[model samples]
Target chain A: MNEQSITLKKKPNLGRRIGDEIKRNFVLYLMAIPVIVYFVVFVYLPMYGLIIAFKDYRPFNRMGQGGIWGSPWADYYGFGNFVKFFQSPLFWSVIKNTIYISLLGTCFSFPAPIIFALMLNEIKNLKYKKIIQTITYLPHFISMVVICSMIIRFFQTEGILTKLITLLGGEKQNYMINEDAYRPIFVGSGIWQGVGWGSIIYISALSSIDQELYEAAVIDGAGKWKQLVHITIPGILSTIVILLIMNIGSILSVGYEKTILLQNDKTASVARVISSYTYDLSFGEGNSDFAYSSAIGIFQSVVNIIFLTIANTISKKVTDSGLF
Target chain B: MVYKPSIGEKVFNLFNILFMALMIFICFYPFWYCVTCSLSKQADTASLMLLPNGFTLATYKDVLAREAIQKGYLVTIFVVVVGTIINLIMTTIAAFLLTRKNFAIRGFLTWMMLFTMYFGGGMIPTYIVYTQILGLEGSILVLLIPGCISVYNMIVMRTNFNGIPTSLEESVKVDGGNDMHVLWHIIIPLSKAVISVMVLFYGVGHWNSWFNASLYLQGTEIQPLQLRLREILILGQTAAEGDAGDVSTMAENIKYATIIVATLPILLVYPVIQKYFVKGVMIGAVKG
Candidate 1:
């Protein structure tokens, strides 16, 4: 009787459990039907379009049937596009610029928010805290286009920022067009726009920390700095790790629009990152080398995926926190 | 009990308050500059004015007098309102579905959303799909459909939905109310704060969008305000660049005028929606 029951249990294993779940939640699945269909069409299907990176990518080849994936010349490139990218003249420049900008951002942009959150949390006055938070929060809501315009204008030869910089012995010309200035400008603007928004999560995390810990520490004669180090830092360490992992994973992705707008021939060597590069190559001369452009994009996404996986695995192993 | 602070604490507090005030000034200065330049006379616009000096509505008149700007404003308003409603419906229903316990496909669906967040077919493939396959090029639907559901926003909505007590839904179920009824009454009422914040977020997204319009709806009459703003601000054009390319005083004055006009609505709406955004983030993050 025991053996028979064990055999029966094996029969109702993982697949059977899933089948039973499907049967039990039929109505719930119905509620999610539209979203499922939307994801299938808009998201999953386009992911298959990444296959075009391997093909010659003729519209005619894709037109007959199977659409974006079933191109007649699927193997025409056969890693050729990726190989061409590696050998391309602009390859090193794009890679260098992308890494430089992203790393710069990861260093300054990531820490500014944490520091701001810590500072804001230290404020004892409620009114001053709220006013400061509100003022800082306003920048994140401003449109990127507007932000880019502001940056451009502020760095103009005669603008206020340029005036300040010139007083510090910088040249009296448009700093926006300076190739060497690209990384600094990009990182600076990123900090200005993102620090407040990024701080929100940390601040929220801070608010949820038990007040009794601080009270206890104070009763034990722990100073504010000691209390912050022992209690506050530990309180929000998990949030910090998760956000850091996210930042590291997305180290490859940057805003394409702002980059494009900011980029002219003057700063093209240092300014043209992955997304902007793909955008430029999308409709180049002589039949819009779709294969080449898609390959460049695939190259970017692959590196990003690699970085993301590394980040996830490391965080999961070390801090027991990760996105997956 | 309030703990007494040391002298070091008092000094720190004073310094922090002053630092915060300076930060606030830094935040407000650009908009202040834009407002002043837009309202100032052409000669006065070049000079740095902390306040609006020699203020006039002539720049506003010139900016509004353009035909494309008017059309752009109308289209932007229409898109933001309609698109946000669609976003709310999709997000709410999806969130509710995600929150359903013992959902067999929940894992699958969540993975799908997360995967999309990390990867995509890039812009060209999406462009081809819209233009060649879907035939949405040059249509306003291009703007609306391509970005109908933002994954980040969807996750926020789902997190909020998960935070709602199941007892509320259970009570509705005991009364013989189905999924729609539970969502319509229990879920929607409880989620007013998140929904409102999502509305503002989606509205701002639609308003600030000009890239898709630049790519797909170029030279169309239904171009959005941000595109028009980009033309004047970045492209440095006057009267949409083609109708009249007066690249001098009128362009300069109208540039700031257009910035103020395009951004003023958001500025006004921001304060009202600001608290909701903070609350929304807090609630979503707690469960996240």
Candidate 2:
């Protein structure tokens, strides 16, 4: 019996071991079946559908009748759609607008939360701080449609922001239609909407900071500004770095919802972004070039992946910490 | 140990107070303006500032009387309730499965879900798959089913689940109970805080989502409140521009009333559950 057991243990079959595990946890495996099927159908199937980027996909060609699989191949050796996008003038403008807006977001909106958190940290009055936090977080929960509507209304010809602009020695024009105002409206509204909610993580990080560090700083004759620079900033530096890396990773993926809601015919020239442009090409009036839009979508995803990888690598090298 | 403050610090403190007050104004004014403008009479909307000039509930009465708004409210309510239920169930199942340490293929499954967070099929392909392949065109199921499970939320839920001591789960096993019993009795009961957070996240997501509705249910009567709000507040704005009359003035009040109506439920509900959201953020930060 000992000899037999030794032989069985020595040459354990992988299939049998897997079978044994499944049998042992039959209920657990059964539970996992739905999730597995869900991912396969909703996620992987769509990924498989990405092949249409290479094919000249026609909706009229139903499945089993020259659909995504059976459609004619795109020109330029399956790179025709990408080639067309590259050659189009809309490509440059959208690319420029996307990068411009994303960069502005990174520069202004990203730091606004950090600064707000730092300022909140300095407030010793707890009740006042709580009140401020509660009020500020309200906008983050407001729907994009409502926020964009408020933005449009406030920037109308006789609107509040227009009046303010005129008071500041500017023309009383409807700023929503002005090409110059799109970026500011987008970025400013984003900061207003996000600052409070975004600051929550940083606030928690600050609280986790050891109080002894601040005491030591105080004992070292550090002033408020000095303590902020030396103690507080360093305390939340890692959180900031991780969040920054993530922000950089998703730099190209400016949410298309707000852009679609906010942009009109007058501002479309300046406001057309990659995702919105994709939506327009795919489902816009009289425009159903699925292959072309899919190519553009693939372009955005590829660049986003590149950006994420680069940011993660640089972060790991510089700070010895990364999202991965 | 009491420390004395410097004169410079006193000046800075005063400045900070004023700055915070300004921030409070900026943050609170938009909603306040909406409330005041919605309540103001048609003639008083233009000159409105600080407070309602000619207060009235006629705008809300007029806005709510619209057939489209009523339908939109029903659609959004159904979506939020049913969609959140599906979200919570799917998320709980996925999170529970992923947290099973000895579960075969757990690592592979986790990696599979995580990869989708980084890469997706993008707009056109996903659209084709949903509308053409799945035949969900103009169907509300398109909104409900596709986003039933957010991988990020699932990961957060899994992280929270992992924190529950294995001893508790083992006791259920000792009582001759199975995985479902342990989940239903122990795991879920102990994770109510995180689950509430999930509900809030998914509920707000469904409530605010308009893009998918616009894409999938365009021109349908089943559009959500946000989409209808967009039509009234944006498209309608453009159509009504350069006109001067009581008609346009009333239209302006209707826009404000629409904003308030669409946003008030969330505004009222959020502050009560604000702590859970903050806790949720903290949990997410732990994973980050």
lDDT score for residue A314 of model 2:
97
Model 1: per-residue Cα lDDT over A192-304, one tens digit each: 88877889999999988999998899999999889989999999999998888888877777779889777666777888898888888875334477778888888887788
The models' CA-based lDDT, in order, is 0.79, 0.87
Write the residue-wise lDDT of candidate 2 on A125-199 in tens digits: 999999999988889998989999999999998788788888889998888889999999999999999999999
Candidate 1 has which clashing residue pairs, if any? none
- In model 2, which regions exceed 4 Å deviation? A1-15, A62-64, B46-48, B242-250
**TM-score of predicted model 2?**
0.95
Model 1 lDDT at residue B107: 80
Off by over 4 Å in 1: A1-31, A61-77, A283-287, A313-324, B1-4, B43-48, B102-108, B237-250
Model 2 steric clash pairs: none
Best DockQ among the predictions, by candidate number = 2
Give the root-mean-square deviation of each candidate in angstroms. 4.5, 2.2
Name the candidate that leads on TM-score: 2
What DockQ results for candidate 2? 0.72
